[model samples]
Target: MKKKIYIYILVCTFVFRIISPAYISASTVYYDEYVTVSYVSDISGTSFPSTKTSYLWEGEHMVYKFQLSEPTIIKAYFSWSQSDEVPGGIAWFSKDMYGVDIIGNTAAISSKNKYNLILLEPGTYYINYSFGKRGSYKNAYNIGLSIAGQKVNTNTLVSASSWENPNVIRTDFYYEGFLSNLQPSAHYLFSVSSKSYVTIDYLFKQVDNLKADSAKCTLYYRNGRVIKSQKYDTRDTSKNKIAVLLEPGDYYINLSDATAPTSLYVIAEPRTNTLTQSIKRYTNKDVTVWLDSSYDHERALMVSSKVTDSNIRSNTVWKTSRNDTCLVIEEDFFTVSENGWYTVRTEDENENYVMTTINITNIDKVPPTTNIVNNKTYTSKSITIRFDDDVSGVKSAKLNGKVINYGKVVKAKGKYKLVITDQAGNAKTVVFTKK
Candidate 1:
């Protein structure tokens, strides 16, 4: 009975924990009567003056109090110019304490907005400011109060997105962001199953006035070494690739900035499910080339291929792009090189080269000629449909009119409709009825 009661109590406690509300403190107490003002050289504390109105979950705050001589209306603003911090807090230029009528609350004070507090009858007033929390840390902030209308609040008190933010991603996603004065680096945390190859790629939208490795990115394993940028004299800013094996765990990635206010793209996913590969067709778009923008290393054609010892063809080093920090790299396999894989490496030593796999797959719009190639002529156990040309790979095969869920392996014998798809996604169906 005692054991049963203990277990019952445990279950009840768990249930209570689940149902209980999170711990939240009450708002800051308001002054009913006018508060006295005392001048200090500076508000002394680790953080800016924060009250219940402050957004700081963990930090200190500064306080200031002064008298307006008589009743007066004033415009009070928080400026970060001298303080070097963006702050959010409550400030009052007028004291309307005890009056049933309500007053101002804490709000963000920045370059764009200022708080205008009307002192119906100013005897004594207190202007308090504190630091606001940004993300998961409580950092330092210097706040400057500017009283625009009737100059009341002062004394250098201190404190301190969404898709445009460092969004968390689970599966394959392609998101674009910028590195600017506001945000210099973009950070991300992602997950992957154990023993999976994570493929990450980032490219500069505009390759002007940046080095070859100027725009860099790093993928750090949850608690392991991932990858980072490399220093190279050449200016080749082809889309950099990071293909690495990762254990099942969360990982952190930081997109390092090349130049302030530069535009870039980030593509992340498993290696097998990698995206952003351009195709080479027989006509106009035969060769896709990336250019080098620096005049010193001007026009150096950058080329890489699947073959470890790659053979780079088109070798016409041209002039660099205007204000360019990029090198020209081309991926082209003309008629002679019908089928194969191509790739290009970034400057990073540990970085995996960006792969563009080209199977030169059957672009045959027409159905592939097929014949029944099976041992023992006819068999009920299994059947094989052989096409004239080797395909990109097997897609699916069916048995009888009913579909056979044969994976890559082909099996089962009956009226079969075998659909073979090539690299370009063109499908050819072959129907064979086996006894």
Candidate 2:
């Protein structure tokens, strides 16, 4: 019996050694990789209360970290497939280092899939998720993570900044913003080529009854002119939608709080129509395209800076039809390679081709190159910067990383370090001290 006990102990030790602390080394992925999500915490109580598979807590925030060796492009995006509740908040880096939120409520997986392809110098980066203004923190639903080493700009409606606060919004998708003590206002920008209806779902989740004027949201024009306003109260539990009928043009959304912070989600639903193809094209500085909508068997012609209107082949189609062909641009819409003169050709079932000329006027996507005209002529007050190429507009001009107001400094100055970012999102940082 003593001998048998010793043998049993030996067997137990062997089993423990084989199974103890298994470690999987990080693999070097050269190509793209759909990153599977593993739940770090089990959902219970308010820690995370939702039917969704993935989620994040408000204050602690869910940190999803991924690592890849060797320098490559990192394409990050999330999908809330078939879920009733989407993230009512923000999805950016763990800390706001990028100065831009990767995704937000109004700009999640709306009508199209959107991904931000950033080239990170090989290391581990955490993609953080959390709820923002509204009280929708405890639970978020249907979050998917996608990653790749190449550019994946396939989303149509990307989130943009609000006028009053930093809340991001997508004209085509939906977003939840807030008006609280710290941030008393929320803003969004939308445009329509023709008449369309707008909807704002204000979530009224309050403990006690409040006065009428305590909370309000107003729709306005791009230039800060009010179009209309609506009021809500704490007693209201239903998502009382404030709908507006407006003519074709540009507009903005402004949500404010009279007493306390309130949560509201913004969505723009274009009136549905049978696309029997006498195609009506619509666009603005920021445009939304429902190209992801099911339209197989039907064909669309694409005309841009490279292609002319005369170029039309029956086999031609919209780049958006293919998940990989679309390119994400200013308004988060899948459009041609560049913003310039372009045309789209749509065909009816009757084999008729209707074409629309679209002139995409916007800032230059190219980075500006700087050159000092004269080395002999220089002063502290003035420094002449001649760009290699004329840009649509200079977003910001700086000398030695200091704020140099345009027209304030002349063509005379000390050593020059000129850094400029044009309209197209490209940036150039040149450090040459007025040599």
TM-scores for every candidate against the unseen true structure? 0.24, 0.25
The lDDT for every candidate, in the order shown, is 0.38, 0.43
lDDT of 1 by residue, 142-196 (tens): 4455442222231111100222244466546555544432234556667776435
Count clashing residue pairs in model 2: 16
Question: Which regions of candidate 1 deviate over 4 angstroms?
Answer: 1-166, 207-213, 224-226, 230-234, 260-435
User: What's model 2's overall lDDT?
Assistant: 0.43
Model 2 TM-score (2 dp): 0.25
Cα TM-score of candidate 1: 0.24
Clash counts per candidate, in order, are 22, 16
Top candidate (TM-score):
2
Per-candidate Cα RMSD to the true structure, in Å, reads: 22.3, 31.9
Off by over 4 Å in 2: 1-168, 207-213, 237-239, 258-261, 272-435
- Residue 282 local lDDT, model 2: 23
lDDT measured at residue 243 in model 2 versus the true structure, 0 to 100: 69
